[model samples]
Target: MRHLRSLTRTLHKQRIEGVTFHFDPHHQHELSTAVRHFFTTPEQHTPLDTPEATRGVFLLEGERKWVLKHNRLIHWKKQLQNYLGLKKAFGLHDLTNEFINLSAVSAKSACAPSVAAFGYKGRFPFLKEEYLLVGFLDDHCSVDDRLIAHPEQASTLLPQVFDLFARMLDEGFVHMDPHPKNILIAPDGQLRLIDFECCAHSVIDHDFSLGFLMGYFFHYWIKRFIAMDDYRTCCENYLKVEQPTLDRSIFMPVFERFLTGKVSRTTRYAILTSPKAQAAFKAQ
Candidate 1:
């Protein structure tokens, strides 16, 4: 069942049971049917073990691999705020935010995936379900996997990892969740970023703090396996790439807070107690 119809200039749209779908004309031929089936009969799709978002894979022989992100309604409080017109919350619609984020990031970086199609499966003001289909980078492993298998390579890889974040920051974007798992290492040794569902755009004209970026690295990388010295090397690499004038001294407070568990209890507990973090700790 081909559900998509042409709009204009590489755009196509489809509507099914109150849900609307948008697709790239270049990929319409390959994506239309698979997208329809993935949404209409989600139960048949096997879920992928993604840490941040619910995902499912729908592979086709001799074709590009497709991964569908099932965006669940996790931030109810934010959704409520959006509904009440109290504040515009980004969490109200995860798939839509990701679709937009991916588009913006793709325009600036080759490392981000191209969104093939996106759709929502509910009425307005109370969207119940949403999904995004994207071209999967086949045979790539998460940065976490690579770092785990070769702890000694942290010095070599952390700089490349920081470079990726530096580029994104230079492009006026912050990947609110730039954890190791959300970043992938392609067979060619290039770093590609995925899972932009929590990404946000920052003002290009303003000087930005490295607090959030450092926090994510500290939580996912330093706390898990990377030595403090290697992590500092990565931070210096990032400074050289993006903010040469900024003092490394500024990072110490945040870094020490994270290291000493003096940061917010919620964030500290979540990172230290997450199953992925636990597994990484056990493997050490």
Candidate 2:
């Protein structure tokens, strides 16, 4: 549960030169050695194949497993999205989006994997990259794909997915890029989220959170993972859990946009930019 607690609580945040480091107060001795091993022996790390738009390495030392989520140092070239005023919408903020989202979630929550440490400057030597440390899991895979292959599993897992989305709506944060790949299925059937870059989505208008949910559930045109009817049923289930008083008519526009955009090149854009999705955000 230490990993699930407030990241700023036990970790001592320090800055050396231009790099940042977080030392675990509870495991100072163990963290010191593990951090060094992860940074210095990058070659021994095995790369995890992420279908989501993310890249990271899995490091093993003795019996511990750690996953280091990484991103290259930013340059003026990386600022083009900012110039276009699409930074937050695209989750390109300097603060790692995953950390931002995870920090807002309750420690006992099952929505995401607990992040261990933040701002680890990797030893690329020739180039620099920032990493977020996450405790490596034992056995897990994409929950979305697993359901498609084993429809029977959906009987129990589908409701859990809907419940998670409803809770997120009530909580106010939204995961911008809604890809099934971001959700993982544990051996016991619990779900966990990973690859947090897209958590920084939507600025003033919070309605897009619903769009995120729609895309997350249906994946719309990209993979056509879930049918429109299935998504509608999901919406109904969501309304019951998050807003039982609201009628289905409330989501018509979002549904219409998704259906129309499915054929158009702008389906993704349409879903994220719509004005009636209604979920507010608590992440700062």
Candidate 3:
């Protein structure tokens, strides 16, 4: 996997005026004409989407819609390069496909529309990804979207979310991004984890530990700023939930692993600011 450290090397070699010739086998006929027009005489390469790549929405026949994410390397924005690199190295497309397959295999009745991966199609050094289309939840709101209206769900959602984390961990995969935006709740109250862009495989316990630590602190961050009591209740309640399962004292060592800076900045912030997190420090 290409870590983000190599971002500079690729960025320095970029030629705003130069173009690297390549071909797409899947859309050979259509992409050939389109790409040639973008990079013809004058050798001008069309600018890729900005920091958060342009999310192109195209409606397919029969109500199926496609969101085209042109994950390409462009010289103008440095951030796009890093995001694209991570997206490719981690094989997000494959992971998501497996997630969809799991939903089918498990035969879970929850309805979030199993994510379908259309397979990643990218040219080396240039990334362009086409995601497998799914039925969009028009009425169902993301957990993040719901929080704006119902802050009270913090008490209700956080603990349940921790349970979800524990379950995923027990299942041997870490849902890397634990933020509310990636969780979608249907009208039936079935919460589905979406966007497995940063997941990884791990031993069952380690995966659960990492996920639990991630969940514990993630909610604590918001709870601290807006709802302190809820945050405390969440921590205390989680301890209650986890206590009967194991040594009842293993949450800290698991948390310290993520604090080492390998995790995302938001995650780090969440861990550092958690109220119960200090117990881990005092223990050391």
Task: Give lDDT: candidate 3, residue 39.
Answer: 30
Report every candidate's CA lDDT: 0.61, 0.54, 0.44
- lDDT for residue 98 in candidate 2, whole number 0-100: 60
> Every model's Cα RMSD, please?
8.5, 7.1, 10.3
Q: How many backbone clashes does candidate 2 have?
A: 1
lDDT per residue for candidate 3 within 27-92, as digits (tens), equals 334433443343343123322223344333222322232222223333433233433443332223
Report the number of backbone clashes for model 3: 1
Better of 1 and 3 by lDDT: 1
Stretches of candidate 1 off by over 4 Å are: 1-10, 16-18, 37-46, 50-62, 72-87, 91-93, 203-207, 233-244, 249-284
In candidate 2 the C-alpha lDDT for residue 34 amounts to 67
In model 1, where is the ten-residue run with the lowest total lDDT? Answer: 1-10
TM-score head-to-head 1 vs 3, winner: 1
- TM-scores for the candidates: 0.72, 0.67, 0.54
Question: On a 0 to 1 TM-score scale, where does candidate 2 land against the true structure?
Answer: 0.67
